[model samples]
Target: MSQDKTILVVGTYDTKDDELNYMSNCIRGQGGQVLSMDVSVLGDPTAPTDYSKHVVAEEGGSSIEAAIDSGDENTAMQIMAHGASMLALRLYREGKIDGVVVLGGTMGTDLALDVCQALPLGVPKYVVSTVSFSQLLPPERLAADIQMILWAGGLYGLNSVCKSSLSQAAGAVLGAARAVEKPKGDRPLIGMTSFGKTILRYMITLKPALEERGFEVAVFHATGMGGRAFESLAAEGSFACAMDFATQEVGNHIFGGLSAGADRLTNAGATATPQIVAPACYDLVDLVGWKPVPEQMGDKPAHDHNRLLKAVVLSASERRDVALAHAEKLSGAKGPTTFIMPKGGCNEWDRPGADLHDAAGLAAFVSAIEDAMPDNVDYVPLDCHINDAQFCETVLSIFDGWLENGVVKA
Candidate 1:
């Protein structure tokens, strides 16, 4: 009974009133405040909510009558989703809500995603859903920091099993709200992308170096979900600069591999954020290791990084296609961009006589990048491999120049 935080309880209160109220009581029991938002389109809650369905629908730019007249459940829910998300954002901005806990099945979960995404990163977003970890939830649909607990056995009515999930979710959201230390924007932030240190070692050196120079460095893994989070921050204009070094997600998007969506490398450019780019692992596409290799990739050399991931080395032609894709994405940059081409090799595994080395493939990729280099991007071709000391120094040199020229503010 020590915490004093407000938690937003969102759901189709018309049907799930009892369950929602149970969660609200749990929060109150923990010394937390509750604000209820009803998103039901057809029925009313037994008691009036702080924000009624009519208020939610109107906030989304439509009326309840228009939603009923539409006669389409999907359309009606979309209207509610838009309204609820906007209202949730407004509540957060006004400092009225500290965290959000949303309850639903598939339809409710769909609306929950929108509402969670409307809030900024670091605001606690918890979802209690029947399809909590199901494939129905794609990486792109999720907010960067969303948490979900499976709504077990609570679909029809509240049971002991489901009560466990609801109570835990209630405590977790309230606890997170009390303990969270949100970004203070104290230092200029740099968003960088790379794999683990075994494959991409630039972050090991660059992070401390950037910190010494008064910049906060956040390095994101280039896997599907990691890249999605990086792009989300970039789109928010959260980073002063983007060091997008590990761009394997671009090749992954091209070759039916694990992807960060079609917009993997374009967010910073779209927001006019200065970006320094390198294709650290441009020669491979990552696929889930347990899945059967696609017939087209069956003949390619593969590396099992772990039980979770497998990397397929692209052929020379495929490497060229990826290089051109990078160029195409960079060509539309609205701000300053620099693409560094490491002529020796792009990744450690592709270096001289390494297990994954393919000199011809590297040559093709380098040539494609040079030939397709856009006018706006300053293309610098270096003699060292991407993991070499010289490559890291070059990056620092460019960043230092930017700082001096006021392109990157400290």
Candidate 2:
């Protein structure tokens, strides 16, 4: 018989015992084993739990009895969330669970986020919550690969709609656990960051060249969540090397625009990952046309990339500051690092006479990076745009050298 996949079903069993039981039965029906973890702080769970509320609360540094005595729902839930996350992570590490599925309304979803974030990528985490993908929970706060489904008609009781949603969630997680191939340890994994495909065409050449050379390249979108995932994966030593070409998130993060949280652009250096850093899209910051523009971008070149997505051009002064910020982060790298400057342009939009083109701004950014770059970092200035064929060749050649010199391994 094939090994049965175990899915950890986490929720407030005291409140949603029937719902949890239904989901557990669904998972069992799908030929998967279920490990129920109850995070309820009040009342007893109708179903038997492998990890009871008392066990969960204790992991969170409090006991369920203490939480009940305190009489603060928020505090008790907070404690339960932490404890549940700890227990869930422990179970995953011990190979007791192959996937996790959690269901709830607001409180359950909040706790689910903790559990999801506690697990690493490729663990098949799913959350069936009423507040599915709500803006209140920013992308940076959750795990990069969490799959959330709207819990339609799932509030207050068991019903046909709730059962359908729960059943689908169970099947989805089980299928994922069965089909998802775990990462192979054969080829070295290379993490690369880029914006839109059209905007960052170098990846087309960059990716194939690296793959041909026997390295697996993973490209991450330069959005807030994508950046956070890249950073998180880097911190976990998931990459043999990284080519961080898209840095618009840094501008947004430093300027309080739509940022990738406070941790953008700091991971590879901290983790000693050999990285090639570029200011590919650092000249722009993300903003929505519906929101009021920042005073710092007053009268500057702004491109309405789309109705809701606007790119504000940074001035020469702002670009200089961003370069300095890049320096501050890159200078502390414990591994071999290179900072490349593409002098012709940073992005497709930054080409001469393009919407984001500004000669003075580019000059200021390059100059600041050059002046501030530490001796440990190799600073290379190429007289070509970032997406140029020559620039791609230059980067690949450097990677080849790194590979041969043992700076990066295949």
Candidate 3:
């Protein structure tokens, strides 16, 4: 028999009472238990909630009276958001809720992001927001696995148009709760990052090879969003080892292109996860293809990946900056660290005769990496392209040594 699934319905119940209750009813109609949390600073819901406004406020280290006394909408909402997020996390930890669905226009959505982020990646976190998919929310504010549904025409009262969104969100969160299969941790898991096989082929060789050594390998795409997910898991100490080979997101973050965040390369180090690092694709930054090219890129050679993304090759000086940034980030690692330098090239596109090949830039990057490498890092330089067989062999050799020395758990 399946376990009973409970979905937490959260909203500003004082203002969105009908909408919140309707969503709760929808979940109940589908045989899912409903736990309502009211995050309202003032006013009262038509019906009492499972977790009330006063409870949420006090849990956040303040009270409803204090929130109202602040006399600023932003301040009051922040207090409520903090409280709601803590309460949501507490509920999940106590096994009182399986999934969470938060409803709101702007204030509610803002709080919802914090609440959802407080939960781990696997638990279903659905946000029914008026600003769903809007650019207003930055990549860092998003939880890696969060699901958002646009609360169309549902800002004020209950209506058929709004009901359509609410009902789907209700069903989605409940269904997700019933179906989620979280990480089992049966085997030591390795988190690796790379782009497409054509761009970065190391994963194609490394993944199966690592699995053969009695490990599970998860490869992230190394795009802005993908890097965020990798960092989130790394911060949680989820990876037995992190083979972070494709690091384009670092360049992206530095150049104000499609960025993960400033914390893109810092999480694994902070968590003391044994990390094997490389500057793969460190010479390029990704920009939105459909938008006007930023002035700084200034006619630099670019590879148009698709209508959605364009890879901009950096100058020799820019590549040097990237190299220094990588070294700086790696210097903070608390666990075992190895820095691999594939001297010939970092990616397939940067090989000789390739479209993005820049011998001078590659040389500059190599020199900078050698100069800035921290004393804590074990630097390994190989005269091979990152896509070459020798690069994969070196990685495995380092990994095997770590295993034998107990730097990494098998």
Candidate 4:
């Protein structure tokens, strides 16, 4: 509904021509500009695309002829997905598009996932997929801010039921682009990760302190999805500095639990985003309500974090393995990095006399980190709990020094 807004409409134009055209018209009727990207690998699109399937394939490093000659649908899909992602990201960075909308059942949604992730945050992304919100989808496959709508009655052809969903998705993406405020220019963004309210006591002190020092702090929760978003953004070089505490997802990843992904702790280092890493909640791994604890971890102390969330304590070996894994990842940092160990305890459940308390396990983690840390990486151990005021002060003090030394911009 905005005159100046531009939306990138993407789909397998060879098959869903009618639906894609209808959606494009709806977007145009709502006063939004459209840039259609056709990801068709088999046949030609019924309607003209601003970026054709062949062009997309070329951008992705393959020729449409090669894809067609091979006669492999999966290979063609992969090529088109990569090309569309490359073109979409180029258009976005060049200011040619402000939002993206893609329609598909399976192939289209897969392609949409690639394109949506290519675009940065604040560029609204919407997906109309028949498989919307299916539990079978992995967290790594879905973009953090993508809005998906179930494509009811949109399996083969467009119908009245399908039109209803299509019309709403068209309007919502345009509306979001118009309503979302443009970020103020070039301010340094600091990313901080936190667990839930259990650790909110000390986490609340961070934003204000960082803001006072003239940095914008974005705090992401340490849930599986939250960790994915944080690391994804970090990999994109979205932050001037990073504080990756609440690292339960790292342990969860190693143990095949509710992990962000296997690559969670590796991005900030890869991107060289000056980061301070901590082992917050590294003593616990998450389990879903519907699933029973794995037999290997059944004997560990467990607690219900909420109705659908379960937290299981890890053994000393588990903690040591987690710490070693993290040390291996941090050792690869190309930028300034610090690993802070809170000696008193890492989590609320790990404090003295708590149900999950294990001093030996905590000690194992610290010892592993100390032994495996690379020479360039700073390992700072504090004699305080993770949530202690002293730990908070120590974190801020280290960050401040980085600021003064120009390791991070304020």
lDDT for each candidate structure: 0.94, 0.87, 0.92, 0.87
In model 4, which regions exceed 4 Å deviation?
Answer: none
* Tens-place lDDT digits, model 2, residues 313-375: 888889988998888878778888988899999899889977678998899998888899888
Candidate 1, TM-score vs. the true structure?
A: 0.98
Give the clashing pairs for model 3: none
Question: TM-score of the candidate numbered 4?
Answer: 0.95
Q: List the residue pairs that clash in candidate 1.
A: none
Write the residue-wise lDDT of candidate 3 on 214-305 in tens digits.
Answer: 99999988888889889888988999999999888999999988788888888888999999999889998999889888997868999999
lDDT of 3 at 67: 92
lDDT value, candidate 1, whole model: 0.94
| Candidate 2 TM-score versus the reference | 0.91
Which regions of candidate 1 fall more than 4 Å away from where they truly are? none
Give the 10-residue window scoring lowest on summed lDDT in candidate 4.
195-204
Q: Which regions of candidate 2 deviate over 4 angstroms?
A: 1-3, 60-62, 65-75, 288-299
Total backbone clashes of candidate 4, pairs 3 or more residues apart or in separate chains? 0
RMSD of each: 1.1, 2.5, 1.4, 1.7
What TM-score does structure 3 among the candidates reach?
Answer: 0.97
Highest lDDT against the true fold, candidate: 1
In candidate 4, position 282 carries an lDDT of 91
Residue-level error in angstroms, candidate 2, position 358: 0.9
Rank list by TM-score: 1, 3, 4, 2
